[model samples]
Every structure is written in structure tokens, then in C-alpha cells.
Target: MEHYLPSFHLKGKLAAVTGATRGIGKAIASAFAEAGADVLLISRTDSDLKEMKEELQQYGTNIYTVSGDVQHYDEIIEKIEQKKIESSIDIWVNNAGINIRSAAEDVTEEEWEQIISTNMKGAFFLTQYAARQMKEKGYGKIINISSVAGHVALRTGVVYAMTKAALIQMTKTLALEWGNHGIRINAIGPWYFPTTLTEKLLQDEEYVKDIVSRTPLRRIGKLPELAGTAVFLASEASDYITGQTIFVDGGMTIYGF
Candidate 1:
């Protein structure tokens, strides 16, 4: 039997995923490892990182864990240098983000700054650092974990929405500037998911119902469901795609109620 595939295999590749201690980021890192890439996991919690590393090791892929806040560029860069990963990072997933929900009028400057710093500033700087490495190597994949809030305003809050919107634009601009260098940049915008960040919302039956009613899929997305898209972007299957945002929102973006 002859099998012809697009070579989705990630053997010998290296992937770095931020906020990989749990939730969607963890799922993406696990998926990348299962697909054959050595994974570098990053998060702020050392204990969580250790546990996640232990769990991911069962996949038989090399795993490295770094504990640091992405908002601190120097620390993140130092950690990356310290790891001295054997292979050049083929995929960089900027999945670390924070959300502070407040009414537009009640949002404080500090709250706004925190949201922007974590979701936009940190993501930009991390991508800049990763893209530099990728540019030198002449090939790389950068996937920013954005949200449906990037496209449409959510009742979740204005500060969070603003940062997400900025991320989408940043993804596009970076893609345009770095595409010639063979560094592809794209974003995945997820809808409601039952992750640590959204656990509160999920507990609210009415809120959950409203979200489901609005979404064509009629259910919240699962963390693992995002893994395939992450792998696709990191693999040769998406070599031709760049400067785009894939909405993994189960048709929520297109649904108008």
C-alpha cells in the first residue's frame, strides 16, 4: 500500500509554547510532541510546569520547561538561551494571555495596562525574539493564540477586547514583514472554552446557554479541538498560508443573532 500525505510529520522539529502548564496551551504542546516535535513549555508557575513536564514525557518526546512571566522579556530571553535547545525552534506559539473583565467606563488604567502588557506587548516581544531566530534559519512558524474577541466585542470587557484586537493586527503586520524571510505568522481565534480562564463563565448556565445558542456548533469548544489547528500551522501543510487568522469558533464569528 502506498500512502501519500502532505508530510504533516514533525519529527526533529522544536516547538515553544507559552502558558503550557494547562488548558489550550498544554493541549497544543502535547499535540506537537505527539506529532514528533521536541516541546519547550513555558509558564509562570514552577510547580505547574514541573507537573506538566512529567505528564508530557509519557508521549516519548523531549520536553523542556521554563517558568517565567512572558511580560518580562529579559527573563524569557534568558530562559530560552539557558535551555540551549538542540534544534532551532520550528514553531513558536504565543499562547500566554490575561483577561481583566470590567465595564468600559469602570476599567482602570492599571487594568488596561495589565491586559495590554500580557496579551499584546508580551506577545509582540516574544514573537520578535522568535522571529529573529527563525529569520536566521530561513524558516519558522509563529502562531498567536488570539480570541474571537479580536473580531467582535464580548461582554467579557473592553480592555481585554482591545488587546485581542491589537493582536490580530499585529499578527497580520508581522506576517507581512517576516513572510519574505520564510517566517510565517498566523493567529488562531478561539471562542468560549472550558479552560481555567473560562471556568467561571462555564459555571454560569445562562451565560453558557447564551454562548451555545449563538454558536452554530451549539456547544463550547474543547481544549483538544485546538490541537489539530496548532499542528497544522506548525507543519508543512500550512507552508503557503501566512498573515491570516483562523477562527476556531465553531461558526460563532459568522453567526448573527
Candidate 2:
């Protein structure tokens, strides 16, 4: 094996991915399984989790499911502790999040609270819990699923952007605080992926056209394309990397036009 090539292999490792039912989260879970990690899938729907476990079983990785709402931090922590049993949670992916697209002034208080609670508060606490476990074992990987909206004003939604930007900062801060303890923290900022969250927006021809024209790659992101970055972050290949937000957008962040 070369210097870092073998670091990409995740054989015998254990990973837990939140929001593992569909879209980016599911794709990331599948990727980790493909990389030979036993995965714990966490989602809100138990039925969906069951189906996902069936689908991911073929990857030859042990699949476990924990169902709960991420917004309910205590409930999620309890479920995770119960399901985790004696396994060391080596990798934790905070992929559970919500977005409410509204103008800054038009955004309701209720919507603001929902977005903040799930996107920011829930993920932060879960990361805290995961870090404590990781600290005990002396090593872990934490990957937070942020958004490109955090980097620049994409006009998606003001509050959504706020939460994501906070995630990026959180990644950096956690990495700084935990680096000596062997816990690595990083973030992924995706742009214009065709997930359930973007189903309605993808239907508008004008919106599609705008996305293509603005993106240097001129194509919306594919679900699988977003998985490799996550796999890399979760694996030992990223041992030297932390506190960085890798934007998985197709040149959207770098484009000047």
C-alpha cells in the first residue's frame, strides 16, 4: 500500500448516519457500507428504516436502524445509546436537516424555530454526544452535512443560510477543541442536489434553467456524486484533515458569473 491509499479502507469500522431514510443521507450510508463499515441508520420513520436496512444488506455490512426525530435531542440520544450497545461509534454523520424557503421578512417565527432546532441545535447536541464517545476511544470522524447556501447568498432562504453557516463554524470550532483528543470534524456543503427537499424546486423550468446557467458544470448534482466526499471524510484518508468545509457544488461556489 502506498502512503495514504490504504487509509481509504474502512473495514471493521462502525458508523452511524442520521437521516438515513432517503436522499443524500441514504446515499452516504450506502457508500459507507460499500466501504466495508457496519452502519447504524437513524431516521424518523421506522418502516423506512426497515426497508433501507433490507436494501443495504447486500453490501455485506451489518446494518442497524434507530428511529427517532432529530429535533428531540434527548430521545435521539437515548435511542442511539440503546442501539449502539458495545460497539464503538467510529464515524458519525449529521445529515439530518430541514429547510424552509422564505424571504427574510416573510419567514414566520414558527418556521425559524423549526429550522434552527433541527438544523442547528439537534445536530450540535448529537455531535457533542458522539464526540464524548469518540474521546473515550481516542479517535472518531464527524461529518456534518451543511449547504452551499452557507458560503454565499444563494437566495434559497435567509434562515436556512443562517443555520448552515453556523454548521460550518461549528465544524471548525469542534475540530479545534477536539483535535488533540483525536476527534476529527468536517463539513460538506452540497449545492442543488435533487433530493426530496428540492423536489418542488426542481419542477420549475425557470429554476432549472437558472441553476444550469449559473453552475459552471451546467448540471444539477447527482446523489451518488455526493457520496464519495462523505466516504473520504469518514475514512482514515482524512486523518490529517479537520475543520474544513468541502463544498461539493459543481463550481457554483467558485463561479463569478
Candidate 3:
């Protein structure tokens, strides 16, 4: 029997992840580092970046940090350009997002704008910049972190679902346009992952039970489970796959009630 698992290794590759200060983003960054990829971590907080960089050093892969607000298109473009001068990006993860859970009738204009600008607008511009560079090289992977809410109407905010659904479409459109250029665009939709955003929900016994009951796995997702999906999408193992949203939801989306 011959072993052929080396294709999954990200050795010698340069990967970039936005929202990498904590939660799913941080997990993905660390997974890439452990797989031998030099990771560029982006976040709005300087302190978080410093802390993450220190924690990631154990993986032995070169780690770099960029502090910027992704909501500003110009800032993201500038940072992408600067990073490009250093190394060609092989994998780009658009993981920066925000959600304000409120009923549609209760959603304020300000809340709507903030969610759309950060989740959709920011990801779009960043993808444009990354895709341009990838087009030049004829090889790249772009991963957008979507959510299960996008697939079905969850009790979560409608604006969040809208943004994520848009992301799924964006992945498909870009993949079709750039497949000839050796670029593969894809998305990951996570459900009920333990993160700062869901800290409150996780603490509520009723909400937790409701979530687990719906999920076939009967439990909330682990952050590392999300990381494994990301690693698969970022590496050569998924070279033939593109434009698909892989839901890491523990069967929540598949279960019907």
C-alpha cells in the first residue's frame, strides 16, 4: 500500500485569513500554520493580532499580522498590495463578519448597514483584490465563511442570512469566471459553533437544547471541526473542487422537522 496524503500539506504556501483574531478565523489560521503554510493574519485589533501571533509560533510556520478595518475597501486593497509585494498568496479566507440578531421589524437602519457593510461589502472587495492577483498567477483558492442560516431561515437575523447567501452566490460566480485561470472559489457554512458571537446562546439551556435537538449529531459544533474543513479547501486535496458550499453543521441543515 502506497501512502499519498502529502497533497494536503500546505508547505511553502502563503495563506491569508481575515478576522483571524479569534473563533473560527483563528482556528483556520492555526490549522494552516500547522499544515506548514506561512499565514498572514488580519484583524481590527492590534492586541489580538499580537496574542495570536505568539500562540501560532508553536506551529513553526512564519506568521504575519495586519491590523485594519475590512469595512474600508481602500484599506484592504492597500494591505493586500503590501502583502503581495512580500509573497504571492495561495489561499485567501474571507472570514470577517458580524451579526445583530433581531426580528425583521425591529432591525434598525444603522444595524442593517453595519451588517451589510462588514459581512458582504468587505468580503466582496477583498475577494476582488485577491482574485485579481490569483488570476495573474493562474492558481489560487478563495474560501468564504458562510453560515447554515443562509441555507434555511433560522431564528438568527435576516440580514446575516442575506449576506451569507450572497456569499454562496459570489463563490459560484467567481469560480465559474476564474476556473480557467486555475482559481477555485468555495465556501463553508458552519452551524452553532462556540464563539464569542454565540456566547450568550450557548449559556441559555433552552436555546442549547433546541439547537442540539435539531442537529443529527445532537451537539454543538467544535471550532476545530470547522478548521479541518478549511484546511481541506485550502490545500491540494480539493484541487478538483470549486464553487460549492460545504456546510459544517453536524447535519442540522439536512434534518427536517
| Each model's lDDT | 0.89, 0.92, 0.92
Candidate 3: tens digits of C-alpha lDDT, residues 68-159: 98888678678657765467788999999999998999999999999999999999888888888888898999999999988898989999
TM for every model, in the order presented, reads 0.97, 0.97, 0.96
In the predicted model 3, the residue pairs found to clash are none
Q: What RMSD does model 2 have?
A: 1.3
Which ten contiguous residues of candidate 1 have the minimum total lDDT?
Answer: 1-10
Q: What is the lDDT of residue 206 in candidate 1?
A: 96
Q: What are the per-model numbers of colliding residue pairs?
A: 0, 0, 0
Which runs in model 1 stand beyond 4 Å of their true positions? 1-4
Cα lDDT of model 2 by residue, 78-184, tens digit: 87777646677899999999988888889999999999999999999999998998999899999999999999988899999999999999999999999999999
lDDT of 2: 0.92
lDDT by residue (175-238, candidate 1, tens digit) is 8899899999999999987789998889999988899999998998987888899999999999
For model 1, state the Cα shift of residue 140 in Å.
Answer: 0.2
